[model samples]
Target: MDIEDLHSWPDSVEEAEALQERLRDRVREEPGPAVVRTVAGLDVAYGSHSDEAVAAAVVVLDAATLRVVESAVAVERPSFPYVPGLFAFRELPALLSALRKLRATPDLLVCDGHGRAHFRRFGLACHLGLLTGLPAVGVGKTFLVGEHVEPGRERGSFTDLVHEGEVVGRTLRTQTGVKPVYVSVGHRVDLDTATRHVLALSPSYRLPETTRQSDRLSRAALRERESDPASAPPPAAAPRGR
Candidate 1:
């Protein structure tokens, strides 16, 4: 894997924050197209060695016939460590590469992570959306950043996720009697729109079908690498500002 030389990385937390601001932007809502054609999901996981990570992108049919269409995977060394609010720096390099390899561009991206529910309101999903200039949503299994009252144990129930007294995202009950997933705007999409998309994409599960497929695909790719190290794709060129 070819990772950018970040040995001389940001000297302090303030510097990292400044750099984040320079590369980031606030999330916005988008009026998605009525006719949905394609939807993509992104998920990442560590390799068997735990030294490398495999990021996968999967596009699926969005109409009544939901089926897997295209998929891609990339491997890269983790960057920026595993800090709470800095996962993008560790994962996006590989994730971006996997996304670029996709043959189809979906109307929406369901990211397996957080978005506005972050410190700078630019979580992994938001960062990826801004970096790729695509419409994306953050669907996190765990709350990374945000506060919210629990939604009722019923499908479609929701409550606002607040941070510092400002609305940032939502806790959505995708499935009745199951824990809800956190929904947030990644980029070019509003929280309401994001929630709606998540609901539409979810046919019969707690998480959207696209994201669940991506999560499975990503982990499978990592398993493949474990079974055969020779098949792993090289990481992209060192990203700028690394």
Candidate 2:
């Protein structure tokens, strides 16, 4: 997948916001896949035994069985400062590098963050999907910027996450008698499809397997980097070629 952005790494909040504004319109809210064979999950882990480094992990799974197919991990320094809504800028570089390491082109991208449910309507999932031209969905653990009524305790129940009077995402109950996860359309995907994918992915746990696997992978990568000196970030990542 080719990631297209006029500004790949923005230093300031104004520059990042401007780049996000430029790319936000490219997102498509369409039904992604009626039957998905493979889905990829992405997450980042910070504090890798050093404040300057972070680890990114991408895990691809067989959607039917929810079994891991492939996984990749990349460690890199934070390219941008920590900003609330512009998280993609901080993590996307490493995530993209890790993404390129995958042998499988996933049918859908299940990211551990928000998508359209953001202040700029462009979150990590949206940025990645727009760049890769893939059907991506954001599965956030916590609410970012939205107001929603509490969903039912039963699994599969949901409430509209309204932000600025617009339906940005969904507060979805993926497991019975558990806290709901937030679902949002990333790119080339809709709310209903995103919600359905989330439910399908999370069978027993509060978080989906994609998230769990990737999280574990990232932390492991960080630990490996801590013991090994050869794990430093390269001057150039193949930048994670497809």
Candidate 3:
């Protein structure tokens, strides 16, 4: 779970955006692992009282059984500002810390955010995949940037999400009669493979099991940090842009 030191932490919005543009070229839009035995879900939960407090969680699950195999959590204050397109800068540090604590190296990473579907096409998933050198997919709860037709009511149905006339992702229906989730290529995963993985992971819920489980764990960790103030880490210095 060692992450590559890709670049220094950006100090401003301009620096972050420039970094994204540079790293976007490194993203490989290819098929992911054919046999995924373990998949890790990544998510972050924020404190209700303080905007700075946050918890990042990584839950590795058995791909076939959909049960957690290993889990880790990191609680820290966000250093980057909350800009719309630069959220990865805010969450990546804590998420990477959590990932480093995991004993099991996941075959695939399912992030609770956008990938190629973002305005810059280098969302959290892409950033994470590049740093970790792991195949990753982005499953967003809401649309970030795209125009797409509504998918069919049946599960597995999907429509192309077009952005700037390019097929960036898919509006996938993971469950029958449920609001579709957005599936985008993170790093080495193609759109089709990403869609199939997402559908398989979400057997009975609108969101994938990876996302659901990680979400719950992140919230629980945040609650733990809130209840015991002494456990909270010192606040990160606010990035210059903020």
Candidate 4:
């Protein structure tokens, strides 16, 4: 699997914003294949309060059956610190590993973070989509960018996520009376199509089945790795000056 260097990890908001704009130019936003048969979800977890991060990915059935197909996991050094507007640097390394290990190419990717919903218009989903050249959608739990009004109580309700006088994403209501998921285009898809895909995958829950299952799988795998003595390596010595 190909793993890019984490040396490009940004250390400041200005650097992060520049990187964000550069990344947007790298993504190709267009109408992708509408007949999606395979879908993937991406998620991450931390070890010992963010010193190290673990990433997990799962591919699943996108049709009415909703069955799992394949999955992968990875571990890497946490290069970027825990910053709100620059999460991509912290998680992208491990996530790239997990994605490379996947058995099949996914038709669509549902990321566990924002896309265009960012202060600089580049989030994990958008970055990954650009790096992989795959169609992706972001479903964030909280607001990282944009201003929007509250959606309706019923299912399938939504409003535009506006920022700087432009509609960048959607505040999607996947299930009735539940908190909405922030939907946005990562690459090779539009906001409307992204919202439709999220709803189609959400048969009985607030989150899409692919995303929820992947989240569970990621957490479970991290816990397993922590508990398994054989899988873990010996700890290194602490830094000399510390």
Name the best candidate (by TM-score): 3
Better of 2 and 3 by TM-score: 3
Q: Rate the local accuracy (lDDT) of all candidates.
A: 0.74, 0.86, 0.90, 0.77
Better of 1 and 4 by TM-score: 4
Give lDDT tens digits, candidate 2, residues 103-147: 768899999999999999999899889778889999999989989
Show the lowest summed lDDT stretch of 10 residues, model 3.
233-242
Q: Is 1 or 4 the stronger prediction by lDDT?
A: 4
Question: How far is each candidate from the true structure, as Cα RMSD in Å?
Answer: 4.0, 2.3, 2.6, 4.6
**Please, what are the lDDT tens digits per residue for candidate 4 over residues 1-242?**
33333236566667877878876766666767587888888888777657654545555565557788788877555666678878777777667767878767888889989888777788888887877777889998887877999999999999999999988889888889999988988988988788989899897999888788888887877788778756762232211111
Instruction: Name model 1 segments beyond 4 Å from true.
Output: 1-15, 229-237, 240-242
Measured by lDDT, the strongest candidate is 3
Model 4's TM-score against the true structure: 0.87
Q: Tens-digit lDDT track for model 3 on 1-242?
A: 67887787889999999999999999998875889999999999989844568799999999999999999998888888889988898888789889989986899999999999999899999999999999999999999998999999999999999999999999999889899999999999899889989989999999999999999999999988889968866677532212
- Which stretches of model 4 miss by more than 4 angstroms? 1-14, 233-242
Mind giving the per-residue lDDT tens digits that candidate 1 earns over 34-128? Answer: 45677788888876655555555555556455687777877666655567787776677677677767766777778889988888877888777
Cα TM-score per model: 0.86, 0.93, 0.96, 0.87
